[model samples]
Target chain A: MRLAIMGAGAVGASVAELASAYGHEVTAIADSNSAAIDPNGLDTEAALATKRASGTVGDDSPESVLEAEYDVLVEATPTTLGDAEPGYSHTVSALERDRHVVLANKGPIAERYDEVRAHERNSEGRVSFDATVGGAIPVLTTIDDIGRSNVTAVRGVLNGTANFILSRMAAESLDYEHVLAEAQDLGVAEADPTFDVDGTDAALKCVILANVLFGGGYALSDAAVEGIREIPGAALQLAAEDGQTIRLIGEVVDEEIRVGPRLVPETGTLAVSGTQNIVQLQTERAGRLNISGRGAGGDETATAVLGDINRLL
Target chain B: MSERTDVRAHTVRLELDDEPGELLNALGPIAEHGGNLLSIFHERGNRTPRGRIPVEVDVEATPERFDRIVDALRQTGVNVVQAGAERYSEELTVLLIGHLIETDFSDTLSRFERCSSASVAEVSLTVADDATDASSARIRLAAHAGETDRALDTIREVATEKDITVISPLTGGDAV
Candidate 1:
C-alpha cells in the first residue's frame, strides 16, 4: 500500500517508520520542521534524533501529507479545538481524492465528525480512528467489534498526567505543584498542560469514543469537564481511608456525558489505580465487559499508530 | 500562544443515560448556542471500570455563548458533573516504590486527571534496573499555588491505598 503521513511528529513519524518496516511504501511525510519522509521512506534514525531534539516534529503547514498521491493518509497532528488548518485541510483533500483515512488525531475528527463521515459515505472510502482514543490499547477496536450496541455509560481515568499526579499525591502526600513539576521533568506532562489538566483532552477522547461506538455527532462543549486541580487531596485520602481512590473519570449516560473526580470503591473491578486505564462496558447482551491498558506513553501511542498503518495496508 | 482573555474555552463532564441519540441530544446545546467544536472523545466499548462510557469534549465560543452552551447542554437532561475554565496554579513531584507491575499499575495512573488547578507534569521510573518485581517511578505534579498541599495529600492517600512508598518532597514547594 502506498502511504503518506499528515504530520511528521511523534505519532506521525512513528507511523511512517512502522509502515516502512511492514514493507509498505510510505511515500511522503509532511512537516515544515524537516522532511521526515521521502519517496523511498523515512530515515528512522534521523526521525529519532528529531524526536529527541523536539518532543514533537509536526509542521504548522503540512500540505505534503495530503498531496502525496498515496492510497491512504494518516493524520497525527497534536490535538486542539478550532485550529485545524493543516490537518482538517489535508483530511478533506485525502477523502476528496478517493483515498482511505486512518485518523490518529482527534481535534479535526471530533470537530468535523459528520462532515468527514459524509465524505466517507459519498466517496466510498473507509475511515477509522482506532488510535485516537486509546494509545496501544484496543479501546476503539474493541468498540468497533461490539458495534451497534446501546452503551449505557462510560467512566474512566482518561487522562494520564492527572492520574499520575493524583496517584503520587495520594501516596506521598506531596503538593500538587511538586508532582506536576516532576511530571514535566519525566516528560509526561506538557510545559503547559492546559488541555490534559483541565479535562479537554480526555473530553475530546470521550467524544471520539462515543461517536465511534455509540454513534452520532456530539457537541464537545456539552460534555462536562472537572480537572483534578480542585479536588481536595483530602477527599482522595478520605476515600483511601475507606479503601477507595479518587479517579478523575468520564461518564456517558443517555443524554449526557460527565467528566470529573470519582471515588471508586477499591474492591470493584473498575477501581484501577494509576496510569492504567480501565473500562467497563454494559451492553444489553454482554451485560458488562472490562478492558484496561496503558493510555499515554509515547511508545504506547506510537505502537498503536503502527497497528493502524499495518491494518490499513 | 493565544490570548487567554479573549480565548474562551470550557471543560465539562456529564452523566448521560445509555440511550439512542443521547450523544446527539447532548451536543444539540453546543450547536444551538453557536459554539465552535474542538474535540470529543468517547469510550464506548468498555465501561468505567464500573460500567459506563465517559465522553469528554473541548469547545470554543464567546463567554456569553459558552454559558449558553453549558446551560443548553444541562437542559438536555444530562448530568453535569463539573464545569469551569480549569486553570492550574501549583506544582509538585514524588517517588514511588514497591512491585508496580504485579498490582496492575498501568490502570492506576489512568484513573487520575489534571484538575484542581493541577496536572501530572513528569514521571521517571527505575525498572528495578532488572526484570525483578521491584520498580519505582518519580512523579511530578503541577497545580494552582497553595494547591500543592492538597495534591500531595492525594498522592499520599493513593500510595497508601495502592501499597506504594512515597519517596519525598524532602523539603517543601521551594525544593521542587
Candidate 2:
C-alpha cells in the first residue's frame, strides 16, 4: 500500500519512517506548511531530516499531498474540538477520492461520527481509527473481534498524563500542582496540560468509544466530564486509608459517556500507575476482558496507525 | 402453600437502645415470626452515632418468614439499621472534597441519610493542617440493591449545592 501521512508530528513522522519496514511505500507526506510527494515513493529520511533542519517537510505546499496519488491517507493531525476542521476535511478528501483513511487524530471521529460514516457510505473507501482511543492498546480491534453488540460496557484509565499525576500524588503524598510540575519536567505532560488534566482528552476517547458502541451521535458536549485538578492530596490519602486509590477513569456504559476521577481499588485492574493505560470491557457472554499498555507515544501510536493500514490491505 | 419454603440464611443489622433486656426483646420478633435463630453478634462496646448499640443477627427462615421477621422487628420499635440480604445490599464508597467544615459536614451527611434508598454506614474525615484549608471525607454508603445509581445521584446533587467535589467509585463494574 502507498501511504500519504498528514501532520508531521511524532506519530506521522514515525509512521513515515517505519512504512517501508511494514512493506508500504510513502507516496506523500505533509506537515502544516510543506509537503514531499513522489508517486513512485519519496525518500522518507530526507523529508524527516529537512523537517528537523528547515522546519518544513519539503518545498511542496501541504495541500498538494491531498491531491497526490496514495492508497491510504493517515490523518495524524493535532486533535481539535467543535468543528474538528482540517482533520475532518482531510478525512473527507480521502473518502471522496475513494482512498482508505487511517486516523491517529480523535477530533474527526469523536466529534463527527455520523457525518464521516455518511461520507464512507457513499464512497468505496473504508475508515479505521484504532489509534484514536487507547493508542497501541488495540481497544477497538478487540471490540470488533468480540462484536460490538456483545460488549456491554467499556471503562478504564484512558489518559496517561492524568494517570501519572494521580499516581505520583498517591505514592509520594504530594499535591496536584507539585506532581503535575514534576510530570511536566519529566516530559510526561505538556507545559500547557489543560487538555489532559481537564479530562477533555479522555472524554474525547470515551466519546469515540460510545460512537463505535452505539453506532453514532455522540460528542464531547454529550459527555459528563470532571477532571482531577480539584482533587486534593488529602483525597488520595483518605482513599488510601481504605485500600483504594483515585484514578481518572473514562466510562462508556448504558449509552452514556462519563470521564472523572473515580475511586478504584489500589490493586485493581484500572489502577495503572505512571503513564500506563488500561481498558476493561464487560462482555455479555465471555465475561470481562482487560487490555493495558503505553497509551501514548510516537512509535506506540504509529504502530496502531500501521496496524490499521495493514487491515486496509 | 406452594411458596418458597426452602430455608435460607439472612443477616439483619439492628441498633438497640442500651437498656436491660433489650437483646431479649429484639429476639422475640424473630421467634414469633417462625425464624430459626442462627447467631447474634452483639457489639456492646461500640455505639452508633445515635448512642445505640449495634447488633448483627443471623437467622434461618423461609423467604416469607424473613420478610415478616424484618417487618415485625421494625413495627416493634427496633431501629433496623439494615434488614435482609436484598435490602441495602450494595455498598458504595466515595470521597467528598471541599471545605467540609465551613459547608456543615454534619448537614451533608444527614442529607445523604435522608435519601430513602441509602444509609451512611461508615465515614473517615481528614482535615488539612491549616484549619481553613480544604478537607476530605471518605463516606461508605449501604444502598438498596440496584439503587446505587440513585444513591450516587443524591450525593452529586448535594455536592453540587455545597460546592463540593465527589470522587465517586466506578459503578456498574467490579470496582463497586
Worst 10 residues of 1 chain A by lDDT: A55-64
Q: Which candidate number maximizes TM-score?
A: 2
C-alpha TM-scores of all predictions:
0.60, 0.82
Candidate 1: what lDDT? 0.65
Global local distance difference test of model 2: 0.91
Q: Return the top candidate by lDDT.
A: 2
DockQ in order: 0.02, 0.42
Indicate the TM-score of model 1.
0.60
List, residue by residue over A1-313, the lDDT tens digit for candidate 2.
9999999999999999999999999999999989999999999999999999999999999889999999999999999999898999999999999999999999999999999999999999999999998999999999999999999999999999999999999999999999999999999999999999999999999999999999999999999998998888989999999999999999999998999999999998899999999999999999899999999999999999999999987
